[model samples]
Target: MPVEQAESLLASQFSIQHTYYRQHYPHGRFDIIMQGTKNIGRLYHDWSGDVVQLIDIALLSAYRGAGIGTRLMRAIVTEAARKHMRMQLYVEFDNPVRALYRTLGFAPAGENGIYELMHRDAMPFDEEAWASVRGLNNPFQ
Candidate 1:
């Protein structure tokens, strides 16, 4: 229950997850979310048949509300739109990020125990709409 022990356990869990993904999703992308010189989070996703599966995305506690996750999600949405593929992800029923996903056009598709499956259909990327989801003005508009 000590802080150090908890951190070590988390690191070990992450390592195990990374290894599992590497072996199972050989073609998937596992990206570190960087903020200038710091590694702030990670994103993992891959193609599942014709759908773009967002397997995981997590930010360090310090970076959770900084719009970084929103930006990364917008990029993924754009990519799925470009490929004309639906995007899907599973979120815990109580996760706050579920609101953001809904704002980005994902709808509740089903449920799996404690997780809810959400799906977003392929649509033309709307920069303005995405920006407004985080209450930001589109810089390029």
Candidate 2:
């Protein structure tokens, strides 16, 4: 895709996502992912239902694989454990983060078109491991 088209497509996709979130999670909040003062990504989720659905989680290409994503996932998992809810998300099949989700105990739930639904059941939170990530201060304690 050309640079201009790619940017437009991304903007359009996010617009659609916002609309969907408004319809499904009227009170949901959008979170900006930041590294120090630098904005790095966005996270959109809803915990209104029995399951905490992760609608979107995106980090800039430069920040991928630096353990930031893992920390966020751990925080979600920890929260789910506290609330007795399952955590779920749909990930594109081509996305490498699928392995990270799997390693974190999410399993294949189903698939639709190019995306696979994955789910992790609530369990004990791993505070110690989450504390070990360099940039992530422990959120569980």
Residues 62-131 of candidate 1 have per-residue lDDT tens digits of 9889777888788678767877999999999999999999988999999999999999998878755354
Q: Positional deviation of 61 in candidate 1, in angstroms?
A: 0.9
TM-score, each model?
A: 0.81, 0.80
Which sections of candidate 2 miss by over 4 Å? 1-10, 130-141
Model number with the top TM-score: 1
Please give the TM-score that candidate 2 achieves against the real structure. Answer: 0.80
Whole-model Cα lDDT of every candidate shown, in order: 0.81, 0.81
Cα lDDT tens digits, model 2, 77-120, are 86787788888899999998899889878999999999999999
Clashing pairs in 1: none
lDDT of 1: 0.81
Q: At residue 94, what lDDT does model 1 achieve?
A: 100
C-alpha displacement of 7 in model 2, angstroms?
Answer: 5.6
